[model samples]
Target chain A: METPLSRTDRTRLGRHAERAGTTRSDLDAVLDQGMVCHLGVVVNGSPRVIPTGYGRIGGTLYLHGSTGASSLAASPSQEVCVTVTHLDGVVLARSVFNHSLNYRSAIIYGVPRPVTDPDEKLAGLRAITERLAPGQWDHARLPTRKELAATTVLALPLTEASVKVRQGPPIDEDEDYALDLWAGVLPVRQVLDAPEPDPRLPPGVPVPPHIARRATPTS
Target chain B: METPLSRTDRTRLGRHAERAGTTRSDLDAVLDQGMVCHLGVVVNGSPRVIPTGYGRIGGTLYLHGSTGASSLAASPSQEVCVTVTHLDGVVLARSVFNHSLNYRSAIIYGVPRPVTDPDEKLAGLRAITERLAPGQWDHARLPTRKELAATTVLALPLTEASVKVRQGPPIDEDEDYALDLWAGVLPVRQVLDAPEPDPRLPPGVPVPPHIARRATPTS
Candidate 1:
């Protein structure tokens, strides 16, 4: 379990901090809620962060990418820091600097070693697939041996991870209180529009329940 | 003026990219479209990447955080890289490694200097607030000099920025295409919910036009 590095690092507002809470279940809850993540790694002594798809299994984060990918594949041996964030709402404040965001984010720091075992590689791949669009794995084609060989999957134990959160109303200075400014949270969320059926579907292909529900976002 | 670094770095189709068709508007379209960006930098010879809200003015990226914030505030003075990504969708493929995303992303590399000038600092602060939520600056209270003093904002010139994108159907191995599997692009998008009125707005303060129009995301 990870705690705020120090007291100050923990946000002051009790509610906002609770909203930013991290639990064993929160990890799976948010991770199951989204598929893509931003991957940050050091290359040539500089930080390079790229967005990629990742799946979480228990306390391990499984990430897969092209073996030929420039940065991720090139620097396979280095310790990488991976983060996945879902922006829930925009917390508007009375003061510009006080503007805050209601978001759920997970940051993991660990050395990610490339997975070489063939069986583990396939499992890792499936986890990422199902994580993105549930039940799509059975609906879609599975990977071939050669394809799996050519691809790269990395497994990072979610040992050193941190979660920080800020949500709700803005905290402004006392003087700004009497100012005539509109202040509140302008809730921002992701909505799934009517799914556009695949162009070549074999007629009457009903939309799956998972995909349908995912289309409608609850902020 | 940002050039593709190499074949691998370019944002094109039939290649390893996502969200291919999203247009690359001159700096404004991309910058104005999104508020949060991942700032990647090296700390103590290690790569440290963190996500924070930002605003772009002309050709500069302005970022702010508490003066006492750990690591992030101190990073601007050193070499830093910033990536702004607007995710359009998740490209679930027949193969796991081929599983990708559709997004518009900008990567900027440079050395950022802290904003000591009071005027530039003020403007940077406004840009961040407005970028997060349009019309926020006008409605929200502006920052005070003393509060501003407690925050640090850095403006990094966007000279070496590069945009990479991918959108559309997934390309799988020829044989895998015949391997009865479901695979296609599942578009992911962000939406804005109805504005939540402030608790102290004295009830029935009709929402502003900007806020009303943005009830649903245009991005």
Candidate 2:
């Protein structure tokens, strides 16, 4: 059986509360679809939001940075908010008052634990790499012990997370629907273009099928 | 001549400092290209990052939310971090240790002021609308007084901001470049797909050319 998602007071949606969901699967879907997330932490008594890549393994979300960076080095004791957002479409309404974006966003809140165990650290790093490139973990060279020692990885449990989604066409007032104007959704998609090989690469290395397939739009 | 961007100690880049830029144009480019941003604010003594839409006019950035939402309500006093990010490509290196994303991001720090004047509110609303869909404000119905009263609009000066950018292929170590593997970048672009009109519309109302042109990729 799968565990259900719970919202502590921190994760509760304050406004537009109707869009919030508490299911673990909903949290998983949003996490699985995104490659980058904004890590929010308070620095010097002020909030600082940094954009970085993340990967989820089971119920734990892994984020890594230089051991010297303040965001990870100072994250062990305090609470952090990690957010992943996907822009699905632009909702153009008949009135400026009703304009909105169709999007799916997940925000997770928790105090992260430092990953010190070697076994779990490798696995976490693998998940982060594979999430960005599905087959590259096995295709590329794994991290060396020295390299791992220099990096700092933090794991934030997905215990308190909220998913808010706004989709479909804009809802205009009843009177404005009659106005003679264009109204619809301009769908936005993140597509991968053709791969560009490194200039120093050998003459015969062909683009791997795993990377080539991503050239087409997925989701 | 355009005013150059200045960086306060808080806005200075702390890590990967090479990617940071203090030019005001760099800040403008990132903001103009993105439609959605994550607004980080402290709510209930914990950091909360909310994904919302924003618009920029000159040195002021405008954000709006329902008057009942706590994020906008509490934003007047405390500092807020507004981030706009564009994921340019996925950098797949020869080693997992060096895997990174190519992206452009802008982080702005300031205390947002509540816009009280009705004229500035409408102008701000128009800028927000037109930024999302160019020529949209002129094409859509203007907001009514009652609708404007129900929304809360906040403006923050662009003076205290920083832009960080990372681009190009992955940078692998000297030894790892000798490995026999495919290594390159997968360019990611946000493209607009064909527009889907509202089904309830009259049969003959066609999509305006301004909206139709967006069907093709720009930038």
Candidate 3:
């Protein structure tokens, strides 16, 4: 059986407790499905939230950036928060106060450790690359020594994370439901369009199957 | 002429300086195009990033949440970072190290002030609602006195902000481009699906024009 997520005071949900997801699977689902995450770190005594790519393998989340990036440089010594959110839909209600968004969000809190071990760094980089493009790690040329040296990878354990999901229709006041107004959900989705080959790319190089599969309509 | 965005040491980009946007229009475009934002605030000496909905009006950005929310309650006294990111596509390169994402992101840092003036509070709430669902504030029942009191609205000025955009194909090494591998961009987009009327909603109340317009394909 999969383990339940550890609930510290920080991970506990105080409001809308019903929206909290307690399983490790919940956290993984939210993290895996997202292509990018907002990384929050305190710099110069103020919070700085940055949108960056991220990856997850088992219980650890991996983030990589240029070694000279200020946010990555300042993160190792302090507690940082990483959040992934998927906006599912916009809930329209009979009342303005009742309108809401259907979304799945995961927040992870921990002090990250810089990955220095060669084997682990390679694995972390692979995970990050694969997360961004599933088959590209094997298809593309692997990073050379100098490229790896220029990158900084940080591993954050998923021991302290929380997932919250809000879905379904808006919960309007009982009286408002009787009003002669329309109410519903406008679903939102992320879709991949046709691939545009690089202008510099040589002629007759077809798009790979892995990338083509994403453009196919699932529904 | 539009006022150029203020440049402070914190807002300055050390790496990829060419990607930084200096005009106020750039910041507004990024903010207005996104439906949700990641809010970062420090709580208990640790950074906390929450995925929340926000609205922008001129020089002020407004965010609303239940008064009981811990993140909202702790944010007014300290500096917070709000980031909005729209992923345009995934850049495929000949090498793993050169892969990147095409995106536009805006980051705003400021100390938020609670909106206490009754007119401003209502206006803030209206902006928040309108942002989530355009034409919603006018169609839905306005918040009553008790509902307004139950909500907390925080307004952050757009004085300290930055915008960054990365677009086009990956910048691969000169030699790697000659390899016979597919290199391109797989575009990513947020699209709206058909509206799902609330099951509890009474029949014969048609989907409003505002909501219907979103479901129509833009491209």
Candidate 4:
């Protein structure tokens, strides 16, 4: 059986307790589907949030940044919070006060360890690259030694994480349902358009199947 | 002349300084376009990040949440960071090291003040509601006084904010450009699908023009 997500005092849901996700898969699903995560760390006694790309390998989450980035530099020394949120829709209710969003969010709290092992570093980088563009790792030139040295990868275990999901139509108050108002969900989704080839491309190189396949619109 | 954005010691860009956006309008544009923002606050000496909805009126940003929320409750006492990010495309380069994302992001840092004035509170709630649904405030029933008392609205100034925007195609190294690989941007966007009316809607109310107008896909 898969291990369940940890529910410590910090991860415990207070307001909408019903929306909290229980199992480990719930956390993974939210992390895997997201393209970017907002990483939070305290610097000079002030909170700083940075939006950056991330990848996950099993229970370990990998985040890469320029070694010179101040936020990344300050992250390893203290506990950090990484949040991945997907806005699914807007919930419109009969009253303005009832307006809420349909979203799935995962929050992980941990002190990340700077990845130093060269082999693991490569694996982490591969996970990050493949997460953004699948099948491109083998097709493109891999990172060189100099390039790897300039990058910093940090790994945070997914031991302390919580997932919250809200979906479907708005729930208006019992009396307010009688009101003459249009109330429903405006479903929102991220889609890919046709790929724009580089202006410098020399003649006949066609768009690869991996990239082209994703460009097809669902709607 | 339009006022430029304040550049504090913290807001100064260190890496990729060229991507920094100048002027107050640049900051406004980034904040205005986004539907959600990640709020960062230090709670009990550890950083906690929460994804929440926000709206900007002039130079002040308003964020609302349940009065019981721990993140929102802790925000007003100390400095908080709010970040809004829009992912434009996947910048696929010839080498994995050169791959990047085309995105626009704004980071705001300030000590939020809890709005206590009843008139300003209602206006702040309207701004937050209108930001998500343009015309819903007038269409829906306004918040009751009892409901207003249960919500918390925190206002943070846009005085210390920075915007970073990366657009267009990826830039590869001179030598890597000769490689036989597909490298370009896979443009991404959030779109609305057909509205799903509430099952309990009392039959004859038609979808408003404001909501219907947004459902038409641009692509």
Candidate 5:
């Protein structure tokens, strides 16, 4: 339902602008496919990028951290960037200059606001938990009132975002294509291997169906 | 030969200081394990994070982009943060508050210097190429003089960096451990699927061993 607008002055692509997607759905696809994002925030007059899990509900992306995390606590006041990327393949060309990676990525720039309302905070936490492992929120014990109070959730609007995607085989110069060389795409995949149960688990606890089904390729 | 010193004022870990590694080897391991890095820079008085490939040789890391790329060109004078992250697993705990991700990440902060010397420029380009596809750099045709001139390579010192690693099962509160719930780690792996040769490649061209070997787990 959220149609992303054209690039604004701040979020415009600087190079290879053709790869930038024109629709907001493209941004949603990239964000939904990724499990983790690199959050860039300024600290002590410099930039710090932290890798963490995030969730998107409609037009807002939610990121939560410990209340004690100075970076997240400071993020509300300063502009921040959240980037999610999926490496699809390695583009091997006949010439080194033409080599590239096939990837889909979304970078969101916004000034996040702290989610102080208890209802929104809980919903945001559910979104994040379900993003990492679907159905786990219902299967596992929910957060307690005290736990919710200790967490800090930041909501970033997707209004200012860019989605760039590149795929398929390498595009080399016409002359280079005649060369006798092995050139193609090597597909990359992120998969969840067999689940490992905790050493302290009671003898008969079974792995839930939701977790078991994830042993396949993700994207 | 590079022995990383103790945390300095710049590289000091602000949160979860216990998870930060103290040795330089830790930084090297994180760098070598990753192919893509999120580069964070300040543009128009706000943070912008871009994802790109990088390579490391000894104490320096090299990044390349089109000479016209505003973000890379603007990075030489201002402070930039290059972060490489590997998502290892999903840590599901009995309590939602205790859920975490097992990951290894390195964040390097420095002012990148433009590599103008031809020799270092070529070498840096080789490092970047080989980092993505190991033997393809040697097998493929090297960049021409014109291509080299059009590219911009920047070298960021590895002296100021922070490495954070989190692994194993979630550590829930002692009382919460008594709950009857399934909890453990779901390992994440990045793997290469079989190569898809370019449709236009000559029939006799064979898949190189360098690429065939990557079908296994990357890290």
Candidate 6:
């Protein structure tokens, strides 16, 4: 269990301040709830952050990318930052300074190693596919030799990750309570509607249960 | 108008490629919809991307901080890459290689300058405040002279900003199309529910229209 670090442990989120009240379960939940993550790294000394799809299996994160000259895939033992954030809503506070966002996010710091084991690489691919669209792995064409070779998978252990969360309404000074300000959380949520089949489908390809079960609201 | 430059456009959302169009309005819309952005810059000849709040007034972007000795803000004429992305959903394709995300994002490239003019500084701060919480600016405490002196705001003109959008369903290869693959959009939506007032409110503080508006849903 890693508690969220804060600037002063005064409740303000901080780094290296031992305020990291985060749990492995917290990171797992956030990762399971999200598919895309912002991969941050220094490229030739300039911080580059790009959002992309990622899959988590147990204690490791597998990011599938092209081996073809991607700055991310080309890195050699460089420090990387992977962030997954879920926006809960716009926290509308009474004061402008107090205005903040309610969100659940996790930032993982590590040096990813390229996956070279063919068996593990294949398993890694399935994790990513199933994570994105549940029952599609067996339904779709598996990666070919060349295509698999062209793909780059980076496996980053999920250690040293920080999960920071902020929920509820604004907490103002006691005196400001009477300032005639409206304070509350404008809750934000993500919902999935019916899945729209491909327009080019030849017909009669029914939706699978794994994918169909997702047509409702997910927390 | 600036379009985001990267393989993100040409690689992932090829099906919705043309619909991946960007314009000045799109950029502004994204700017208005977001309160925080990932600030990317070369820190000490290496890249470091940090999440920071920014307010964009038309083509000018205002960002301020009080880190005191941030390697990023301290730079005078460094080239910076700023990205504002609103995540739509995690696109879980049937194939690991095909996994993607549905998102609307903007990337701006600029040479930032330290704001010096007093009036411009005031306006920049206001822009930031208003951007974060629309109607709360007038109700909040304005930055004091001492606060202003300690904080530094950088003005990044949107002279080279670009937008990249990925929407709609996953497009698999022709052969894979025939596979009984469960494919479609797990449509990502943001919902804004009723506001929750502060527990300690003194009463008589009504919710403002800006805070009352519902979330904008786009498929």
Best by lDDT: 3
Across A38-82, the per-residue lDDT of candidate 2 in tens digits comes to: 999987777888888788999999998889887778688899999
Residue pairs clashing, model 5: none
Error of 4 at B47 (Å): 0.8
Q: Candidate 5 residues B167-186, lDDT tens each?
A: 99888899988999988999
For all the predictions, what are the DockQ values? 0.49, 0.74, 0.85, 0.87, 0.73, 0.47
Put down candidate 4 lDDT per residue, A75-134, tens digits, no spaces. Answer: 886899999999999898999989999999999999999999999999999999988888
TM-score, every prediction: 0.86, 0.96, 0.99, 0.99, 0.97, 0.83
Give candidate 4 regions above 4 Å deviation: none
Q: Per-residue lDDT of A63-154 in model 5, one digit per residue for the tens?
A: 99989887898898789999999999999999999999999999899999999898899889998999998888888888888888889999
Tens-place lDDT digits, model 6, residues A63-152: 877776456654548877777777786666555555677777777767888899999898888887777677767766678898899888
> Per-residue CA lDDT of candidate 6, range B33-89, in tens?
887787766544444455667898777998877646364454558777677887676
Worst 10-residue lDDT window for candidate 6 chain B reads: B5-14
Error of 5 at A127 (Å): 0.6
User: Lowest summed lDDT over 10 consecutive residues: which window, candidate 5 chain B?
Assistant: B2-11
Give fnat (model 1).
0.52
Better of 2 and 6 by lDDT: 2
Give the residue spans of candidate 2 off by over 4 A.
A217-219, B217-219
What TM-score does chain A of each model score against the native chain A?
0.83, 0.95, 0.98, 0.98, 0.95, 0.87
Pick by DockQ: which candidate is best? 4
- Where does candidate 6 stray beyond 4 Å? A1-19, B1-26, B41-48, B68-79, B89-96, B139-141, B146-150, B215-219
Specify the CAPRI tier of model 1. Answer: acceptable
Q: Scored by Cα lDDT, where does model 6 land?
A: 0.69
Tell me what TM-score chain B of candidate 1 gets against the true chain B. 0.82
> Candidates 4 and 6: which is better by DockQ?
4
